[model samples]
Target: MDDVTRFLAEQQYVELTTFRRSGAGVPTPVWVAPDGDDLLVVTVDGTGKTKRLAHTDRVELRPCSVRGEVAPEAPRYAGRARVERDAASVARVKRAIGAKYGWWYRALTVVEPVLERLPGRRPRAAVVITDVVPLDS
Candidate 1:
């Protein structure tokens, strides 16, 4: 990761803005962590955000303050996110995010263990790794 990518990954949270099927905007708060040279974001498969990403890989991710307020006119980073479905990668990514964020992510882990041996209650999907190329590229 370059300076810009590294800096963006270090932020507490990122605004993941995707386009709705109706050509409207749908933004959500995403927990992201750096994966060597890419950004990894976690989400379920049946979500609207996932469907939107399938239609258009293009997305805007902006680093926000800890208080969750972004500067009114701050510059946002532009990139495309390719959804990944690898088990190992997803586990590693989740751990990284939890470690960096500390408490909140840890809570999620407590609620849902990565390796669940339950018979009928398994997670359908893990996480989506978004390999980002700067907009200027």
Candidate 2:
């Protein structure tokens, strides 16, 4: 496996940093799964990172703690991200995530729909990131 895929496979959470119009980086912790040569992340559709990615595909990924804390010595990978809205693509990503995360993934599937029905809850979407390049390269 390539470095990016290997790193992601060993990590439970990754810090996905998306750029804002002002060139600021917003980092969020997300569950990630290997998808062929790419990585997939499922997140709320209308989140800032999702909106920012729409304008700019440039993104950075690094193994991180569940709370978004980055390990100082971890390598960072760069890639272009695209949101996936189609049902088939979304289902594919969902299955990948579920397989990787197991019970936690199952629990989320059970709880997310109820959470979405609550006031102020946002719908979820999947993002596929391609052309990942290690920053050291």
State the displacement of the C-alpha of residue 105, model 2, in Å, after optimal TM-score superposition. Answer: 1.1
> Which parts of model 1 are misplaced by more than 4 Å?
65-68, 114-137
TM-score of each: 0.77, 0.90
lDDT of 1 by residue, 53-136 (tens): 778877787776654567776557777776555787567777778777889888767856545556555453444435554554
Deviation from native of the Cα of residue 75 in model 1, angstroms: 1.7
lDDT of each: 0.69, 0.86
38-105 per-residue lDDT for model 2 (tens digits): 78888878889889998999998898999999878889988899998777888888888998999999
- Tell me model 2's lDDT, rounded to 2 decimals: 0.86
